[model samples]
Target chain A: MNVVDLIKSYGSKTVVKEVSFTVPKGKVLSLIGPNGAGKSTVMGMISRLIARDAGVIDFEGQDLTKWKSKELAKHLAILTQHNNVQMKLTVRELVAFGRFPYSGSRLTPEDNEMVDKAIAYMELQEYQDQYIDELSGGQRQRAYIAMVIAQDTEYVLLDEPTNNLDIYHATNLMRIARRLCDELGKTVILVLHEINYAAFYSDYICAFKNGRIAKFGPVEEVITKETLSEIYKVDFEIMNIGGKPLTIYY
Target chain B: MNRAKMHRRNVTRLALLAVMVLVAVVFYLLVNSHPEKPKLFQYILSLRLPTLLCMIIACISIGAATLIFQSIVNNRIVTPALLGMNSIYSFLHTAAVFVLGTGSTLFLNANLAFAVDLLTMGVVGTLIYWYLFKKTGHNVLYIMLIGTVLSSLFGSVQSAMIRVMDPNEYDALLGSLVADFNNINGEIILFATIMLLVLAFVLRRELGLLDVITMGRNQAINLGVDYDNVIRKLLFGVVLCMAVATATIGPVSFLGLIVANMSRQIFKTYKHSHLMVGASLMGMLALIGGQMISQHLFHFTVPVSTFVTIAGGIYFLYLLLFKKGAY
Candidate 1:
């Protein structure tokens, strides 16, 4: 999809301004920025979970606004920032909601299998019946991710999937995001605060500053000390460990 | 879902439904055997059948309606009572007398009163949901405030009318103020039953959407469900069903909270199909059981309204506590 200068405002207060980027069809693009840097806002607008005040989003060389919402949902799925689901559903039942576009109310056997697979993929096999509200923080976040992953879309947009998760589960989540691109050929776009994880697991890093793209390209280009210092305003030392750049700013 | 567990849950759900129906039917039989009700199906059908039908319909409709409503509101502790539907109902009855004068109210037909109440409340509810949620950028607080204000205005008008009416007529109106099976709207009962069944069926397709919705509106919309459209559709069904039930049974406000809470505890899931059916059955059981106690045991000739309110009131307190502690 090609996006040109995307901007979103809430009652005249601009949240995301003149953001421009192009997401390749089969790449993992990670957006790493400080909190309230319009990362989630950009994600929301791109996924059409919220409206944009300015800019154009084109999918498959067509305008995004022209596409019907259901059609858009088929192509892209979003795991939003607000992950508090008030429903008392189990992991499996919650995951089944991903197939709502294809299967309205009734759960066909095939849909059932997909839900099972999504649960298993999240490594939540044993806790499928456990109430999601009763699950641990990491487990619940994985459960939400599993639901979006089960949507079976070409592009998956996640806002802070690692939020509220422990180190192990957080790494596990980024690894899964990588696998979505490498194995399943689905384009994964995520907003993560931890820059090192983005540099480690992502094919590309898209940097945003004050609501616009500071830099957008390969991980090698975006993770450099010059760009990192420019974006974060912190003195950073970059080290290449296992061929991937790692930034340390204390 | 595994075959074994799925079968087990289905069996348990079926058993629960059967028990609820049994409670309703058995109590209904006892209530029908009263001195005022004649023997034989057709003879008893006049007074008791209508009462049975109205009670069952009101109980089920409001019960299931509140289940969906609470899910939409995303708070199990809040029911339609929080929406101020009940107080709005009393306001309508009292205002009609005060505004149109005693002559018109005295000559007013029972069915007509119910019809007017249903129509006016229906319009108000639709307007409230639309204006607050749709036009003003989906604000729930605005909706609640408007409803509360309208409820208070209606209540004050009704109270003033009561002070002016003849003491005997005032007593009669007050007596009918609280719902009882004795003063059943038989014609509207059939209408309500048909409306309940139809809405329930239509809402059945909406159950899965509701399950998705209970995940919260933003998540539901992200998953491809048209969140606003779906909410409007469900709320319309909710308003219609609640209005008919309330008008028919004379406002058993908190009955819904009790039944919805009971169902959730028994079967722990957010699936609307299970929640709706379960709550409806439980409501029927509670209504029937309460009526049985009032008739056979107390012989108090008192309306079953107090039992529903008191029981539901106590249950509401328990739910508030549950929300405070329970996850």
Candidate 2:
């Protein structure tokens, strides 16, 4: 659960330079940064979506790079920025895709159990049979999340999970992300633009600035007014509401 | 959207395929009895069997391959031809005739020339997949534009070569490309049939993979499917199938589009296995039906391709006008 010195460069330019951090098991790590700060790039490298120029990721004291893709997929799942599926699959069918890592294409009895559990976990049982395109943005997002949850991976990486979601669904998504770690004991690593959501829900924050990790610590240490102002280049006031830190930046 | 629905569609498709194969078999029997240059039945047999085989080969393979290509590209408008595969094939043919003289076009080693055509088309097909998909990361439009330009350039070069050829060879060259199935050699038909079967066997593993591929890259990769490998293999498979179809019966313009669109409407599922199996049957049905009517009903020796154009043309127009059809 520790990443040792990860670096990613994009052809004569380093999009994610020499970044390193660690995520303990059963904890949430939110990556926050301004646009084009390589937050997504780091997530891509960790999830093997984008190749790293130089890095070593030691998860459970094993080199992540050396792990077989199938094995890695079984332990980790990623929901990317755009889920432009080519098929008009139903929510249940889409969720079933998450089980592909456990077995090959054929879903096993165990896979079925996980798929059903994920569907229930996401509160999507009502819309399970509905076509994904026919669903509202929030419902579709939940379905996509359900698919990742069905992967049953130890860690789940999501990029801009709230892109098209309204506040109600966005908050629902953050709450579910926290519940995955607290109740299910899964590490949730996310790249999100919503600083307040990150501050409120995250146990730890890993802020990236210019392809580098600016700070990596508990939420209390990372979401301070000065740190928020530096990372986002915007003035912010940290207000604690119901004992949870909220960074109000306008 | 419905599991039962997909299964039902599959069953219906299988039944239709069975019926088409039975009809094709009956027609094959009828055509076999006719002889090469003799009385009505004998003359009919010689002409019809080749025509039957050629139509069957082009229709089924082109339809199936085009459906697969469209699935992988995630665009309904794209066909194997849009990849400039036919251009690579026809260009090679034109070049062979230009340099080797029209005599070389009919070389003693027909197998060698066929192999050359297949290999060249295969390479071009692979390159098209590699360049647009893997190398440049370009979209479908860029790929199509590049392919269209290349095809036009090759077509012009081919035409220029044809213009300069001696009038006597020109007649022979033009005649060869005209695709009168009666002129088909048994050996060529046999070769094409075997190739199709072999391709089917090889692509069996990829049939399911195509379904996941349409889900796009992130989901495919997250599911531990090697997206790049599967795409390359499938695209290559389409090229092989397309080359066989074209080399066997010249280019049947837009046959893939016709079959794919028809199958999508009928099946309503995005699985490649279903689409391919369904389209292959639809293609054979189209070909076989066209042949039967042309021989027994129309009473004219019209090419099967011509009949397909009428059907395909109408379907194409419907698809264009139907806004929801884009999905």
Candidate 3:
């Protein structure tokens, strides 16, 4: 997927300005930035949840806008940071919603198989029949991810998937995300606030500072002390942890 | 959360279904019963049959409209009444009486009057929703606020007109204002039934979409459902249902909120198929049950609307107290 000179503005204030990047297939790309730095906005635009003011997104040599939304659903799927559903649905039922584009809620044997596979993948089998509202924060987050995974899209985008998770759950989510790219050969894009997680699990990092891409490259090029301090306006010291760059900022 | 618990929930749904069927049977028997029995059965059938049909129409409209509206907005607390459709309806009723006089052809001809009501309310209803969308960018709270204000404005204007009209005319208008199945014209019931059927057929294909919509806008879009187009179509369906019902039977405000929430609690599912069916059954039961109580227990001294309000008001309060934060 390639985006060229993307621009998004709300009223007189421009949120994303002239951003360009390409996401290689079968790799994990992390978007790291501060709050209001346009990471989520860019993710939304790419997912077509938000319209772009200008630019082109080329997916499979076709303009993104030209692809029908249903067709796009088969290839690309997105999960926003805030997943608020006010309906009373159990975990199994919620995961089956991911099959809507394929069967429109009439679950075939294949759809049910995928739903069960996703439920087992997220290790949510115990909570599969539980109402989403009755689950803990971490469990609820996993249920949503399971829904996205069941969608079986080749390109997946998640915005801040670990907002309210504990350390163990957060690391578990990142590991699962890494396996989605490595074992499944699916391209993954994510917006992350934890620089350490971005450096640890991501193959590519795109750092945004003040609504513009400060730098975009491999993890080694984008997570250095100089780039980290300049983008975040914080003092940073880098340490080699398990042969990966980990930032120490106080 | 377990198989046993799931079984219990299913049992509750089955029990509710049984109760609805029992209530429907009782409603049919009661409507068919007459004091003269063998002699007056035909006379009673002529009168009560249309009234029964009218009751069905009201149930489908109010029940289906409220459930669909709440699902689209993803709020269990609010109904389409918040769109001020009921207020505009009352305004049209009062304005018709004041302008055409109670004895005039416009006021006395049920067919002409229903057409005027349906057309005016349908056009005005569409305009209000369109205006709200354009002005507020589909902000739920903003549209609700405007609807509340418009309701009060229509109420004040209607009261002012009623005050100036002849007392006899006001009395007749008052009878029309409070929803009662006894007074509905047979032609209007037939018309409403046809309209509701057409709407049902038109919306048959999109029934599952309502469930998707309850997942919120972003998720619905990501699932490949055309959010804006579906919403607009559903809004039109809502307006049509509300308009036809309001035109036939006067506005019953709390009934929808009461029954919709009850359906959700009983069904324990997000699927609109079950929710709509459950709510519609509850609506029919409430209207018929309330009518029976008012007719037999109170000897017709109290109106059915009074019974519905008292019962629905209590249920609303109970839900608010116990399930405060679900919305």
Q: B202-308, model 2: which lDDT tens digit per residue?
A: 87777667777778777777777776777888888888888888777777676788878777777766666677777877777776776677766766578666877
Clash pairs detected, candidate 1: none
Candidate 3: the clashing residue pairs are: none
Candidate with the greatest DockQ versus the true structure: 3
Q: Return the top candidate by TM-score.
A: 3
> Candidate 1: DockQ?
0.54
> Tens digit of lDDT per residue, candidate 3, span B1-327?
654576577667857775876766556656647756766877766766676667767777888899888877777877887667788888977897898888988778777777777777767777778677657865678878888998899999999998898999999878766555667656787778778888888977666688888898789889988777777777778888887777666677788888788888877888777677778778778777776777678777887777778887897788778888687
- Candidate 2 regions off by >4 Å? A1-5, A9-12, A59-65, B24-39, B99-106, B164-172, B178-186, B294-302, B310-314, B324-326
Candidate 2 chain A TM is 0.95
Local accuracy of candidate 2 as per-residue lDDT tens digits, A62-155 = 8876777777888899998787665567888889888776765678898889999999999998898888888888888999889988988889
The Cα error of candidate 2 at residue A187, in Å, is 1.4
- Compare candidates 1 and 3 on lDDT and give the better one: 3
Q: Per-residue lDDT of A91-130 in model 3, one digit per residue for the tens?
A: 9999999998899978999999999999999999988988
TM-score of chain B of 3: 0.86
